[model samples]
Target: MSRSYRTVHIRDFHDDDLDGIVVLWEAVHNAVIRPVYSLAEVIASCQEDHAVVAVDGDQVVGAAVGRAAHAQGWVVFFGVSAADADGQIAADLLDALERRMAPLGLAKLSVLVAEHDGRVAALAGNGFGMRHTLRYLERPMPVQRRELDVLGDVGGRILPRHLWEAVAGMSAEKRLLEERLVTPLAHPELAERFGVMPPRAVMLFGPPGTGKTTFAKAVASRLGWPFVELFPSRLGDTAGGMAAALRATFERIGSLEHAVVFIDEVEEIASRRRGDPPSPTQGVTNELLKLVADFRDGSGRLLICATNFVRALDAAFLRHGRFDYVIPIGLPDAAARAAIWGRYVPASVDIDLADLVDRSDGLTPADIEYAARRASQEALARALRTDGGDAEPLGLADYVDALAATRATVSDESARDFLADIEAYGRL
Candidate 1:
């Protein structure tokens, strides 16, 4: 047999390959006197469910068998011949099996392996993580109906775990958030033991485009809680006016078991009060205050209010009892700008990191993202205009040009005012 592993090709299993697959499986688990799965079962799986085999010409080198039930998929059988037990074969077989299973609309795919199985490391390398250890148990079902699903049709979404990790930079802010917000919610038992009561309400005050909304979503992602964004502007235009809509929305939110509710640009409705005539939004503001008070009284929920102009908000809205903390998310510092630039710049591109970082001193995360996008767009446009010639590689010069053209979203005066406001009222 040729030793060139590159000759291996992955394809759907066939009936003729059953004997080879069974031989490979038996060889891998030779220590087991009794078969883990019967030959008949394997044959049936090859005929009925999704199964892929890695073949080196006519020889079956590996097999992966999976089945989808409901919204979950399981890898029931996977084995590679001892002679060809390379990571490449294992990874390819699993990848092929997953490709076949993906279109079946499964939310998750899982595999079970012995704790000591060396294949565990290979599986992890291919993006599988150990979520839990299973010990099968049987329980009686109650006769009554149970509202076990906390995620109702409340317009809330549960973000994946990777999102929090994807949010680069702002280490100081992220650390503070973990300490003040994530810790209390994720580890309530620990918090209680330390006499640290979980914070229910907090305000994220920052200049525009400073990543307040992103941080809110990241918080929800980190906590594994449902993110419910309350669009006050949209709600305000609904029937019975903004106040009534706000009240109804909160009422609906109360049903959720746990939630991280975010209200962005809150000053739209909760702005500073006016003269004797009073603004129409005053009613909405009062309704919001009442809702916050009630929400604060409850447990298993956190309210995150964000505003670009913290000074524009009503004085009562920022009081100690109303909000637990007034966190400030300012413009990205040098380290943060570098992270933002790194995220948007393609790995293949060559650029000056220090120059880009230094030049992006006053830019927000959003501004840097926009600049990066604009640079790419200009590069593509130039390439197109070059009549099919290879485009000049995107480089530091392109970013510098883009930065020159792009205006900073937050002005120097505004930044100074933000700093002044933070000094006067910032809590964290």
Candidate 2:
């Protein structure tokens, strides 16, 4: 039986496939294959250098040759047979080659493809940024610098650039933040013309699983500022207790040129005070109030505080002058749920998204994400257990099943209370 060349499998080149590889090179390049490497040289490359081939049964249809030196690497040779010029085969060959070379800690991998080569499109599709003929392409590796010290001092971390875009939906909330917080910080001059002083601090209030923390990080990312999450619990064990640690953290934050300090579940330390023998956290709350006042006086910084129960917070904490805006991040609406669902489910899968979205009413973003993941996991397990037949794609039925078994993180009562809180306290 003739070997089928349809199912391309990418693997390391073998000694026995020399003739097929040579034929593939000749067939693809034709006149361009001048001074081709000898069989001995090719064999040596396969044995020593990073090399991979796309094969179908016994036939070699594509090859990629890569070599790494010090902190740099180069794709020296890449060719695919004319008969098998599909972009998928070329992409597979490149994928295999890159996987083999990635562990070498090479700083950069470059390929010099001809201007008119059809493979250029394929390379671009695989994340190879283009450069003009006269210009050189360069990408600098991220290096940790002294500026990051402030983040460490305050128990903070830098968020990735994509986090802002990764926030699936919440158009109204995102827009409000962008206008009330992001716009003033990003374009101060424009804000000044509108009599808008850049926001110094804001409060994010909602139910537990409503993505308040994620929104805080996203805000920092959008402004290209460092994210410093002050953990009150972690500070409680410090030398001076939570109040002293909180003061010291702010002092350290004051040193940085720019920052977005976040404190999640802030009500823990800033809860309403009672008469006579005040709460143990009263002193801590007083210290925090002073810190917020001091922090607001400084420029180039924004403080974000998140709370599950806004009513539990001290009235002074939510006063008009203290917090510029008190935004509410509630459960995902139908449109928001659809967007979140789209993010978790593979686009290739055929499912009734509208039905799923309708069924996911009152679900938080975290809840939807968990349900979608569960559906995917269940589908994957079923596919693995199947013996021979092509596995069925995860459909609406699978997701519905997962949804039935998944517990909603936020209960209806909690959601109603959150709505009430927003009505009573929401500012933006």
Candidate 3:
């Protein structure tokens, strides 16, 4: 039933849909998420929202996200891409949610939506009345990191160390799972159940810095697969032109046997074409869909797509048989965070590694590394002040101050929330 319904039925929300969700959010909302509403906020909404996506074979044509609230409180965060922002998707999300919330006595359902938009009208058409408008806040300040250029190549397509690092710490049972990453050979049981399934699209969706890209890189590196990363801009100048580009992408990917073809922030290439004008990259989605089916067609390349916003995606890309696995990278846990922190802290520094890791809540590995370096620099500066200062080692104060100074840059609160979100949504 689930597989048959993939043609029109709504599927669940996933991290691979992140890029799509973000695009629609940025496009229609005329807004940006940060400071006030971090990526964790989105994950938290998803926590309660029984997000459903509408799929047709290998193409995701529509999507909706909604959940029940107390006293039939409300359902929010529902929208479909490039179309009237309506409850078409909402109704579907709400139907599933109502059942989930029914035991809790979910009564009248509601949604927070744009007043004039068709979606709002559609929700209203579906029995939701206008509610008081709440301002979606935005921060006037610059993004804290000041280093927004995450696009810079981070060690070109090498096997990332962390996945293997994670395996090193896991038990033997987990090692078997990690083995899947190293060897493209799917486990016989899993292969029978999912590997040989009709479509073989792999979706990687999550907030930035959950190591989505790094994990894929690590997997490719571990498997000794040649990796290729593509972007929306690669789709060519015009619609027909884009189709050709899309064809070329897979054609190139197809040639790599037992190789990994990674599409980072893939939703840009995979969004559905609704009533809205098509972006240059529109055709790429359809093309990729066909390419994914080729997995069953016998081209042995691993297809991986990653995005930060999954809600905006077309559902076809998420159909079970298409991608053997759909994974969302959650934020690092306390142990992972502590380990990241420990790596950045030099053995030369005389500080409690445990205390440092405990305090680093929502930090990504990169963030932890940045903070550790600053702390070390500060410690070195302080040591220079004493007569024998050069002989003195860096202390906890340096690490603490280093962390404190960047506190607002990447708030501790944000870190915790992000961590929690990942733990809840992370597939691994």
Candidate 4:
């Protein structure tokens, strides 16, 4: 008798058995019809969703994965190695997966198989009927099930897809980012043909509230990657201290397939290291430097560090090979200011777009947003006090008043400092 006759046990999938599951998946994939779900989906479901494996001794001979959706349970993956020619193990795996999902109150269990897939008989025997009239379609989700727990632990999230498009202006910055960062990373295959490596780490330095954080989040949304913000202040809350916590955070980040990790006001931790009295941040700075080195070695991840004070960082931290690009984010210009204005002004309100754009010359994106919101709030308050009828709504005058009331986060001295820093340290 063949080794297929040996006793096999069906059990919950262990993390270590992922490799064995991969082998079985590859075996079926190499055969006739391709699996309906991608390998990524199957792997993610195996880890975070429900899964069962049939093990013959130490080898995985068959596997099944399922996901519960309200009253419906869907089979995400089902495969058995060639050794299970009798199809008994395939049936057993399906049974085990169904039992695991029993408590979910699933009224119907279903699966979509590619045309002519050999597992039809096994599924049919397990009481899954053919839905001839029904068709299956899917749009991939940005965040996978497995990454949710890890993402939550790291205070990461999947930003809205509209974020990239919603970035009102900064056309120059947008163009530069698109060419230097987005293009290469988004199209890795094309990038490889041109012999260009996608950027791993980059520094965004500018006057305060210049939308550095917004740009970072937009990039993550555009790339469909998880955005993880590492706050230097919060790191010290861990029992291991800031340096140790920093290391542990990176270790958790490593578990994700792809991520855009941002550290705002990084100068707090990575500032100039001095040996005279041995600065307090020296150890954290050293640990961060090492983390950057290790982060660069990994693929499918980007580290974005933003600082208001570029000159404050350690000289060694800004050296060649540490950051792929040291890009500068400055205040909004004429065209950018106009776009920012358009985003906040209501369509019904007739406002002088050009006048407002020309007036708010030095203001950052955040400043414009605050002014716009304040105008709306004050307009509403005025309307509330008077009779509803003929109550003057928000207008260009309100916006102008709000703009005058708002203070620019970037002052003349800070703006000058930013320009000087760009000339001194800007790489691209």
> Which is the leading candidate under TM-score?
4
TM-score pick, better of 2 and 3: 2
| Candidate 4 residue-wise lDDT, 1-428, digit = tens | 12233588888999989999888878777557877888888999999989999888898888899998889988888988887777788877888898899989899888999778878878888888888898768756766788889999999988888788887678889998888888888899989999999999999999888889999998998888899999999998899799999999999999999999999999999999888898889999999999999999998999999999899999999999999999999998887788888888999998789999888989998899899999999999999889776688899889989999999998898888888998999999
lDDT of each: 0.84, 0.83, 0.57, 0.89
Q: Write the per-residue lDDT of candidate 1 for residues 1-428, one digit (tens) a residue.
A: 11235888888888889888888777666453334455666677788998998888899988888888899998878887766545888888888888899999999898776656666777898889876767334332211123224344456776776678877788899899999999988899999999998999999998999999999999988887778898987897889999999898898888776789999999999999986898989999999999999999899899999999888899999998989999999898787888888888999997788899998889988888889999999998999998999878788889999999889999999899998988987997
Model 2 alpha-carbon drift over 4 Å, by segment: 1-146, 384-393
lDDT (10s digit) by residue, model 2, range 1-428:
01223687788878787788677655645444442343545556777888888787788888888878799987767788666555777777887888889999988888766545666777888878887764334432222366676667676676786777887778888889899999999899999999999999999999989889989999998887888888888989999789999998899889888889999999999999896898899999999999999999999899999999899999999998899999999887777888899889898997788999999998888888889999999989889888656888788888999899889888889988988998999998
Query: Which whole-number lDDT from 0 to 100 does residue 186 have in model 2?
Result: 85
**Model 3: runs farther than 4 Å from truth?**
1-163, 166-199, 234-242, 383-392, 407-428
Query: How accurate locally is residue 176 in candidate 1, as Cα lDDT from 0 to 100?
Result: 94
* Root-mean-square deviation (CA) per prediction: 14.7, 17.7, 24.4, 6.0
Q: Is candidate 2 or candidate 4 better by lDDT?
A: 4
Candidate order by lDDT, decreasing, is 4, 1, 2, 3
TM-score-based ranking, best first?
A: 4, 1, 2, 3
> lDDT value for candidate 3?
0.57
Winner by lDDT between candidate 3 and candidate 1: 1
The numbered model that scores best in lDDT is: 4
* Cα shift from native, residue 352, model 2 (Å): 2.1
Candidate 3 lDDT over 63-169, as tens digits, reads 55455556764554555555324345555544555554466676666655443555665566666666575655543321123222221221124344345455222
Give the per-residue Cα lDDT of candidate 1 at 196.
90
